[model samples]
Each structure stands twice: as structure tokens, then as C-alpha cells.
Target chain A: MARRGSYAKGVAKREEILDAALEVIAREGFRKTSVREIATAANLSQTGLLHHFASKNELFTEILRRRDEVDAVNASTDPEARFIDTFPMIIRHNSKVPGLVQLYVSLATEAPDPEHPAHKFFTERFEGFREELVAEIQEGQRSGEFNTRLNPELAANSLLALADGLQTQWLLTPTLDMAAHIEAAIESWRSDPKP
Target chain B: MARRGSYAKGVAKREEILDAALEVIAREGFRKTSVREIATAANLSQTGLLHHFASKNELFTEILRRRDEVDAVNASTDPEARFIDTFPMIIRHNSKVPGLVQLYVSLATEAPDPEHPAHKFFTERFEGFREELVAEIQEGQRSGEFNTRLNPELAANSLLALADGLQTQWLLTPTLDMAAHIEAAIESWRSDPKP
Candidate 1:
């Protein structure tokens, strides 16, 4: 079996590569970005980089997987809290990471093609995202924390769309106050009267 | 100078080419799509197609311009009416044209890159779209049709985001009732309490 030290080193190296890949993708876009460039940025030879990810597709998949994990961690700060309550904080946190957001928007658009490698990943991501938001809305309605008259499914879908759409627009115009817009949208859904 | 008959024929031919290009783009994404394929679909030689649009960039720009013209026409059914008031109708009309929607979503995502051919087109499109919506929201507030408390710019941004975000989601799940979701979201912004 490999020693623990080497395994830890491997994990660190992998993360370093992902960070470099994200930087390149953010600057050059996925179509123009090359694996060699990522390897160079990571301070590894092409062979060494390939050792961690056998192909470009593998590398991109891992990047997306890592992103989802990070998002899950961000969403889990309070397990018992409604997910929608945490969205503004999450969106605010996201604005600081433009490269990651660009990578996501870029991949999500391309992945709509059923043949794309990231197709299934994006499909499941949206499904799970919508399902979780819908559940949260329903739970809030049941507890009278939300407007019961609102259709949970429609609200859930709109919320998801607003989040995603704002992200796309924000990428184009960094000056946009993304979190504030999202907060305003969510605030509109509150059952309580605004003071 | 060209004769009137030949000029009309040329215009008809250009439209035919654009229609075929849209079909090809919808079937195969922009990345996988080729000019040769478009020519084949349009029943023209590649050289003949080039005579109409000197480059792929020129063709794409023309297609986007035409789409904007069509959208403007759709929104102008009642010139005196507010633009936001017609968004649901426009979005519903969009639902009938999935190919156009796919082309738009695909191009908009790619256009975030400053170097992308469609970058300027999308930038201007978003800017104009937001400006128009903001103006409409302000007008509505003035007329007491919408909540005066709503920030016109924020509401306009959110509305644009909702439209784009829903389109992306609808592309993923065609069963989604996109128009209803949009209408519901708009209803939430009404100043007058729902009876």
C-alpha cells in the first residue's frame, strides 16, 4: 500500500491542477483552453497532469464534481434551515469567484447536447436543484413561513431560473449587483407584509 | 445596378439560407455545425452561400439581427402599451420556436467572451432589453399599474434574468409551463394585493 504522506501529496497536487484549470478556463474559455496550458500552470509536465486526469473530458468532469461538492458544503451551513434562506449568502459568495461561475455557465450551455460528456451531470444537477428548492418551498408553505397561495413548483422553478439567469448576466456585466437582485426576488415571495 | 427581380430573388435566397442554418444549428450545435452543411440544406453550393454571407460571423450577426427585428415586431402589437405587459405573450410565442431558442441560448453563453464574434451583438441586445424593461417598469409605476416601491432597475434586471433563466430550464425540460411561471412571478410584483 502507498504511504499516507504520498497519498496526501497526490491529493494536494490534484487540487493544484484543478485550480490552474479553472484559471485558464475563466480567462480563455473551454474551447480555447488547452490541457498543456493547464499542466504548465500547475507546474507539472503534460505526462504528470495526465497521470491525474487521463483526458480533457476527465479533467472537466472532476472540476464540475468538485464545484458541486463546494456548493453542497456552502448550502449545508445549517442543515435544518430552509435552502432558500441560504441562497443569497451563496450567491454573494459566488460573485467573488467569477472564474468558477464562467466555467459553470459555459459548461452548462454546452452540456445541453445529449452527446456532450457533461450532459448527464448538468441534467441531474438541474433536476436535483429544482427538486430541493421545490421541497423547501413546500416545507415553508406547510409551516406558514411562506405564502401558501403560491404554487410551490412554479416558485421553485422561477427561483432557480432567477439564480441562473442572473449569473449569466453578471458574467457579462460584472457591475451588476447579483446578490441584491436575487435577495429582492426572494423577498417578494415572503408571506409577511414588508414593513 | 441589379434589376428589381434579381434583388427580390437575392433577398428570398438569403432568407432561405438563414432558415436552413437555423435548422442545422438546432440539430447540431454551433461547434459541430459547418458551413458546408448549411449550404447543403439550403440547396446551394458553398461558394453560392459565401456570396450572401462572406463569413460565418457575418451570417450569425445577420441571424441575430433578424431575431431582434422579429422580437421588436412581436412587442409592438400595441405601441402605447408597456413592454413588460407583453413579456408573457412574447415568452409563450418563443415556446413555439425551440430551434430559435436553442440558437439564442447557445450563442448568448458563448458571447460572454469579449473575443467571441457575437459578443457585441449580445452586449447591445441585453443593454437595450434591460433599458426598455426599466423604462416600462418606470412607466407602470407612474401609471399606478405596478408597485411604486419597486426599484425599476432591479425589477428590470430580475425580469430579464427570469426570462433567460426560464428559457434555459425550458430547453432542458420542455414540459415546463414557462409562461405561467413568468406570469406568476410578475403577479408577485403587482402593487395591488391579489383578491
Candidate 2:
């Protein structure tokens, strides 16, 4: 019973660290933030923080995972929210967290290599994102919210690509209005002739 | 006369080095290709090769610039080719050069920082690309090759975003047919009701 209690405490501490890390990154920007800063924010020694993660890549990946979890929670707050509906909200949220966006772009660039620690996480994430989009797009088509003539798989891929591509551009030029560009793209599809 | 000859020689040597680097990178993936390996292929010592460029970032940026020049030359070979017309060829060509694609993504991710050496190159590149695309799209609309109602600026941004986004996805999953996806996107605009 005592051992199980210690494991539970460990998990709690890890979550606390991740929350602190997220807060720090969102505020200070990822490039300017370091592990030491995150550890200090979490009220743990650098060594103590290191004990929770296997490597820097693993820790960074977990930070992203934690972010997704937080976004999911926010998404659930809207019971009727569909995947397509939440896209603009997510992009707007991302704009406010430039540090996290920087971290995502940097990590994604490295994640393509099979040997990179984040490779598996990214591969699975892409697959899952694409699947969710495809399902939602099909549902939208059935309800006449989208053009039924469009290919769901292709549309999903294009939407995902637009989001990813716009982030990079928006990072370079903060005034670009990524959310607007994306919304326009989505609206264009809706205006297409219905099957 | 001696000074002029030496300057010409320097220019010739730099071009030779860039040509060799491009060939080597195209054959070996960017992550696996090293400066030392590139230097060896050019028959120059690493230091000697570095002397021709300001830094690694500069060298890589120049390599990409060289690629654009080569592509332009290829496009000019077909005198009637418009910017939109050559997009598929560009994408198809990119598919055959994964190393360059990797290098581009990695550098672009870094280039968002104003202090990054490649920052200016990317800013100008994006602006120039968008301008060219907008012009070509407008021309297409005039010629009845595109949807007249579609906004040229928005279409250009979407096309550029699609190309950038698709490259990252294709890098992650080599089996993805980026060229086809882009072609379909362009075709959709073409099929839209004429204004």
C-alpha cells in the first residue's frame, strides 16, 4: 500500500511539473525558456526534474501531450463542438502561445527522422488527426455543411496542411492572421456546389 | 588584369562548390549529409569551402537559391510556362530531392527568428513567391483558366501554404503524393463556376 502511494505521488509531481512548464513556456517563449527555468517554476531541483523524464526530447514531447490534453478539456466544455468548429479556436489559442508554437515547429522539423525520439509521437499524432478530420468531414458532408463532391481524405489532408503551413508563416509575420486565412479556406469549401 | 582574373576564378570556384553540394545532398538525405562530406565531394577542405560562404546558414541558403535558379532555367526551357503551370513540375522535382526538402524545412523553422541568418532570405522569398503567384493567378483568371471569382491573393497564399505543408507531410511519409494533392487543389479552382 505504501509503494502504491509513492507511485501516485510521483505521477502527481510529474503533472505539476508539466503544468508549470506549460505556463512558463507560454509566457517566456520556448526559445528563451530552459529546463532549469521549468524546474525552478515547479519548485523542484534540476536533478529532481530530470528524474521524471528520460531525455530532453521525451520531456518536450510530454509537454506537447499535456497541451493536447488541456485543449481537449477546453473542447469538451462545448458539448456540441465538432472537430471543424474547434479549429479556429485552437489556432487562436496557439497564437497567444508563441513559445509553444515555436517548440512545435522546431520539434516537428526534427521528428521526421525515424531515429528522433519524437518520431513515434508525431507519426501517431498525424494519423490520429487525419482520421478525426476525415470522419468529421464526412459527417459535415452528410449534413450539407460541406461540399459532398469533395474527397474527405483529400480535404482533411489539405486542412491539416493549411494549419501547419500557416503557423510557420504566421510565426515569421505575426500580423498575417492565420485564423482568418484558415477560416477563409474552410468557407471556400462550403460555398462549393452541393452534390 | 591579374585582380580581375583572380576574382573570376573565385566566382567559378564558388559555383563549382555549390553544384557539388547540391548533387551530394540530392543523393544523400540532409540529416545524413555532412559539411565534411560535401567538402570532400567538391575536392576542397572543409575550411576552404567555408571560406566561400559566411556561415553554414548562408551556405544552405545559397544552396536553395541555386536550386531556384536552376528551376527557373528549366522553366524557361518551356517558353510558354506560367508560374501555375510549373508548380506540378516543381513539386515533382522536389520529390526526387528529399535532402533539399529536409534542409528547407529545418532552415525555415529556424528562420522565424529575426536574428537567424536565413531570416532575410525567407522573408524576401515568401514575399516574392506570393507576388509571383498572385500575378500568375490573375493572369490565369483573365485567360479563363481559373475561377474568376476567386481572390488572387487568397489563392496564392493557399497554394503556397499547401506546397509548404505538403512538403513536411511528404517528408514524414514518403508515400504521400504531394504533387497530386496540389494538382487537385488547382483543378478545383479551375472547375469552379465562371464569374
Candidate 3:
């Protein structure tokens, strides 16, 4: 029927546009990426691109939403685990999609702009991410696997920061042993100082 | 006389080019930032821009070098105390220049690219930075100001990560109590869990 054809076409257009955005972002960088170029990459006219999304910001939000969906699926799988496991997934996923990774890094800087959609996302992300992380640490505390004196919230923040910062370094040096580096971080936590 | 004239002109041209780069980076993200626009922004023809730097990579590197120099100067007055003082300095300085702060967060993500000139600079920067941080923690441990159980290297890494991560977040949310965040992180080394 006509309705079925239109629905399929709509789905195809949505995917094609995303694929184009991913390519454009990777080639041109996040800020320089124009919808025109994305339209070109998608084999659609600029008007056609416009027909799909209301604005560039909307397109970007869709990209972020898709990314979050993927993370949700991955994160939900192993709801219970040491941060050691979860941290690696983040790094691993990041490596696979360099364009998205660059977008994240680049957008993270722009997140400070009050008008940017990502600003709210990051604020909520940071607050929620920290709470979730601290809960994990507490789980470790419950099992007596971690030092009882370490503050969970502080430890969570530090660990998140370390993981993110280390990735920045690793992006420059792909060969950098991220897992090993994290292991070293965990070792530091495990090593009781000379009393 | 010709040499002197050229030198002054070159210096002015370089400054002009830098101004353009900053503007473009602020307007468009890093990758989208074009050499052509930078040249135009500086009121120079493409050839004029090429005369100063062979390629875009060089220009990017120079920008990073300049930033490093600025940071060095900021911390130069007390390089030895920078480990402890840098955190507070970052908090204070960031409020004054929001653009530079955003630039840093964005570049921090991009800086990891080995091909980026800032790669080795940041790598070596962190190594040296870490050494200083470790020394501070060790001194704290020795002075009985910090928990003797703290692993100096791990603590140092975590601290640096926390500082970087917190700085990125604060850039987006300027209202954050940066100094308080730092102090809380430091204080977390203690705070025994409930039985």
C-alpha cells in the first residue's frame, strides 16, 4: 500500500542520514560538519535533508540518542560488576566508533554553552553517572573487597575522571595499554601503604 | 632594514593568524576549522598563510605550543608548588577566560591524537606532571598529613584525572564549586565506612 511504502522510505531516510552524519563528522570534525554535506553524503538534496530533521541540533540529538541506546543495552547486560569491567566496555566501544568518539570529546567541550543541547545531557549524565558509580563502589565495600576507609563518592569521581582522562591520552597513542593502565589504577587502590 | 621590517610584519601576521584560528575554532568545531578561513580572518591571502606554516598540522601544533607556554607561565612562578597550587590556579584562571577553558576541554579530547602536535607535549606533560603530583602525595604521606595507606602513584594519577575531569565539567557549568570539589576529593582519602 502507499502507507507501507512511505513508512519504509522514512526509515531508510533516517538511517541514511545518520550514516551520512557519521561520515561527515569523521571527515570534517563535529563543528565544521554542515547539514549540507551530510545531505550530499546521504545522496539527498539539502531540502530533502531539511525535510527529515527540523534543525541541525535535532540531528545531533538523534545521534546522541542512538548512542545512549547502545550504551543502555550494553550497560544493562552486566548490571552488577566491578568498575573494572564497565570501564573497559566504555573504552572498547569508544575505539570502535572514532567519529562518535570525536563527537563526544568535541561536544564535551561545547557542552558548557548554555544553548547547546548537550549541556543538559552532560549535567544529568555526570550527576547520574556518579551516583551509579558510587553505588558500584559501595557494592565492593559490602563484599569487603575494597578498603573500608575510602570514600565511595570521591573514589567514584576520581575513577571516572581517570578513565576519561586516560582515554584522552590513549586516543593519541592507540597502542597504549588501557586495560593495563586501569589495572595499575586498581592496583593503587589495592596496595595498602606501608603502615 | 628589510630583515627587521619582515620580522615585525611576520610577528604581526602570526598574531593575526592565531586570532583567526581561535575565532574559527570557537565558531566551528576544530576539524571544521579551515586553513582558508584562518588565512582570511588574518586578512591574509592563502599564500600569505602558507608562508607562515607549511600545513594545517603545523598551525595546530603552534596553537598547542602557545597554550602550553601560557600554562607554563601561569605555573612558572612556583613550579615546585605547582602540583598543589595548579588545582586552585585552574579554578581561578578558568573563570577569567571561558573561551580558553572550552578550548582546553575540546582539545583535551583531540590532544590524544598522536598525529596532533600536542600529543607528545601532553604525554610528556602528564609524565612530568604526574611525577610532581606523586612527590606531593609522598610528602603528604611523610608529613602524616595524608593517609599512610595511600598509593602515591595511584593517588597522583587519580588526582590529575579528577582535576582534568572536574575542570571539563566546570567549564560547562561555571557555577560549580571547583575548589570545594578538589578539597572533597582530597578529603575522601579518609572517611571510614560504617560497620
Cα lDDT of model 1 by residue, A110-155, tens digit: 6767766677787787788789888887887887778887887888
Q: Candidate 3's chain A scores what TM-score?
A: 0.73
| B-chain TM-scores per prediction | 0.81, 0.91, 0.69
lDDT of 2 by residue, B1-195 (tens): 477588888888888999998898888778745678888989988898999988877888888888888878876687777778788888988999999899888888888878877788889988998999899888888988888878888788888888888888888888888988888788877845646
The prediction achieving the highest DockQ against the true structure is 2
lDDT of 1 by residue, B1-195 (tens): 267689888888888788677666555545535668778878888888989986876677667677777676877677776666777888997887776777777777767778777888878888998899888778778878888878989988888888898888887778888899888877876786656
- The digit string of per-residue lDDT tens for model 3 on A1-195 reads 467589888877787778667666656555336678778878888888889887776677666656765666775476555545566666666666556666676666667776777778877877877888788667767876666666776666656666666556556556554555566555544524435
Candidate 2 per-residue lDDT over residues A67-144, each given as its tens digit = 988987876687677778888889888999988998888888888888877788878888998999899888888888
State every prediction's TM-score relative to the real structure.
Answer: 0.84, 0.93, 0.66
TM-score of chain B of 2: 0.91
Which candidate number has the best TM-score? 2
Stretches of candidate 1 exceeding 4 Å from the true structure: A1-16, A23-31, A45-55, A74-78, B1-13, B23-31, B74-78
Residue A138 alpha-carbon offset, candidate 3, angstroms: 4.4
- Candidate 1, CAPRI quality class derived from DockQ: medium
Candidate 2 local lDDT, residue B92:
89
**lDDT of model 2, residue B134:** 93
Off by over 4 Å in 3: A1-47, A75-85, A138-148, A179-195, B1-88, B110-124, B127-159, B179-195
Q: State the lDDT of candidate 3 residue by residue for B81-165, as single tens digits.
A: 5466566665566556556555566556767565766567677777887898888788877867777767777666656666677
DockQ of 2: 0.70
